[model samples]
Target: MNKDHYTYRVTWSPEDKEYIGLCAEFPSLSWLASTSQKALAGIQNVVAEAVNDMEANGEPVPVAFADRHYSGEFRVRIPPHVHRALAVESAEQGISLNRLASAKLAG
Candidate 1:
């Protein structure tokens, strides 16, 4: 959420049968998935993995949006049942739902 960083939109495309993810400002880093949530999850996982891999290999992580900016928000709508479960689990762990989701996905 840095002001100088860029944000990407990950969306579902039924025609492609996959989630379509791409940075509006960085077109080269695009990916796809089968659902909107999955696409968002995939992009986060892929980006984190890529960063970790680069760090492991002693390579500099790419910074395509060092000075770029974003104004829109990204939304990933989960089912009501799933949201309830996440809320319960997050409370049990004493963490916010967003933190819980991020930790689960990062793992």
Candidate 2:
């Protein structure tokens, strides 16, 4: 897979005084540079080398988030007491329990 298809994040490091680039799909790899662009490029090069090494060693590369599918729905179970409290609160707010729960979880 091409490096462009992978996820790259560049964040400032106060301790290091430089931008740090990390690849989400390749969690073990990172790069630090003076500029965000250089950090990103460094991480991409690292990922390329890692991919080549893995292939040479017959190891599999990770699939990035861009290649995955998310349903945006999941099931969870909570205690009965919490459920009752949320239901009452949702009723008082004049909104469905699902909406209330979603809002609470989001924020």
Candidate 3:
């Protein structure tokens, strides 16, 4: 996998009247451009350079979380009332609470 495949977002900035490019893996880094495409490209280029610098300096590269695999399992903590409601609804629908919740989350 490419180490430079970091998550990025391009958002419009009303104040600057430009698009702001941001990288999730490097919160401290950002770029601005008049167009969203330019913003995205600029941030990607910066991220590539940063990754190269890290490699040259023997620093650990940030992992791209979207590339990670996941089991269909995770834990969620809900209030007692929410938990009870979900369980009751699932029971009424004749489905497991996990499946019901998973479907809701998927939507």
Best lDDT among the predictions, by candidate number: 2
List model 2 lDDT by residue over 1-107, tens digit each.
Answer: 66588988999999999999999999999999999999999999999999999989999888778987898888999999999999999999999999999999999
All models: lDDT?
0.71, 0.92, 0.90
Runs of candidate 3 with Cα error greater than 4 angstroms are 1-4
lDDT at 42, model 1: 66
Candidate 1 lowest-lDDT run of ten: 1-10
Q: What lDDT would candidate 1 get against the real structure?
A: 0.71
Across 1-107, the per-residue lDDT of candidate 1 in tens digits comes to: 23124466877677887888766444566678777777766666666666677789998765656564665445789999999999999999999988888888779
Which predicted model would earn the best TM-score? 3
TM-score: the better of candidates 1 and 3: 3
- TM-score of every prediction relative to native: 0.44, 0.81, 0.85
Task: Extract clashing residue pairs from model 2.
Answer: none
RMSD of each: 14.3, 1.9, 1.8
Tell me model 2's lDDT, rounded to 2 decimals: 0.92
